[model samples]
Target: MKLIIRWLLLACALVLLTQLDSGIQIRSFGSAMWAAFVIGLLNAFVRPLLILFTLPVTVLTMGLFLFVINALTFQMASHLLEGFQVQGFWHALLGSVLYSVCSLVIDVALERLLGPRFMPPPQ
Candidate 1:
């Protein structure tokens, strides 16, 4: 239930991002949902690989390069979908930043609402 709620909220955030002229456009709620799901999958699967491959750069940049990895994941999602459009690399970079911020806010809100039971155990 919490997962579903988070997913829907993230989709809504994506829609709101399009309104901000973030250069990311979503054709419909369904598309936004798909985009959110794709992004999640990419983050779960691709992001780790990217981080590993760019470990040296990430270390050199003191983790700032993670933002570029996030942008690449965002752009990859846009390319895989028809209704989700990102203007270019820069647009993806901005969209990824916004999306990450929104997701963090949503997670915090959910944590407060649902309690720690739904959150992961501390590493």
Candidate 2:
């Protein structure tokens, strides 16, 4: 199913991130997968709330404050999950950027390969 594929891609992205960043670590693929799921849930539920609360700053910064929000969410995920670590704020920022880029690329590739059915219509 699409959900499983998305989860696997996210796990792969996390694994790739660990290899690229010494400050980010994952104990195993299983841990990476779990971290990916947690991260997704956090992004889905917590990110919107954080954005809502930070609207003033986000608006003042022309939305650039979203980077900080994303990094904080990523760091929070590291704290909540076992066997996954983000060393510092800088690392968390870089890891969040990397995660977004990788996930975007993978999703685009899947959409292309699987046709329109693989991706939802853009709003």
Candidate 3:
């Protein structure tokens, strides 16, 4: 399924991220997979709540505060997982930004490869 493929690709991206950033350390491929899943779940369930609560600051900062929220979630993920470690606040912020970039690339690639079946028709 598309979901499974996307998860695997994201995990691979995590592995790649670790290679690209010294601050972000992933123990193994399996650990990367779990980290990816946890990150996805946090983004799905927790990120929106945090965004809503921080809306005033986020608006005041012209949406820049979302990066802080993302870093918090990234740090939370590191705390929750043994194999995935982000060194410090700065590392967390950088890692989160990198991970988000990787995720975006994966999503766009998937959408392109999967084509119209996974996309809704224009209104």
Candidate 4:
């Protein structure tokens, strides 16, 4: 299912991030998967509300504030999950950016490889 693929991609992204940065640590594949699921849930539910409430600041910053919001979510995930760690605000920010980029790239590659049949239905 689409959700399973997303979780796997996120876990892969986390593993890649751990390899790239010493500040980000993931203890195991299972831990990474759990962290991915939690982060996905937070991003799905909390991030939108945060963005809506911070719309003025987000606009004032020309969307830059979203990165800060992402970092906060990343930090929150780190705190809520065991065996997954983001060292500091800077690390969280960088790790979040990296994770997003990696996820996007992987998604695109997978889509191209697997074709449209595997894509989730539009909302």
- Clashing pairs in model 1? none
The per-residue C-alpha lDDT of model 2 at residue 97 equals 98
In TM-score terms, which candidate is top? 1
What would the per-residue lDDT of candidate 3 be over residues 1-123, giving only the tens digit for each residue? 889999999999888878887989999999989998999999999999999999999999999999999999998999999999999999899888988998888888888988644567678
Question: In model 4, how large is the Cα lDDT of residue 85?
Answer: 95
> Where does the lowest 10-residue lDDT sum fall in candidate 2?
113-122
Residue 6 accuracy (lDDT) in model 2:
83
Q: Deviation in angstroms for 118 in model 3?
A: 4.2
Q: Going through the candidates in order, what is the number of backbone clashes in each?
A: 0, 0, 0, 0
* lDDT, candidate 4, 3-29, per-residue tens: 588779889889889999889999999
Off by over 4 Å in 4: 117-123
lDDT of 2 at 89: 96
Choose the strongest candidate by lDDT: 1
RMSD of each: 3.4, 3.4, 2.7, 3.3
Q: Residue 43's C-alpha lDDT in candidate 2?
A: 97
Worst 10 residues of 1 by lDDT: 113-122
Ranking by TM-score: 1, 2, 3, 4
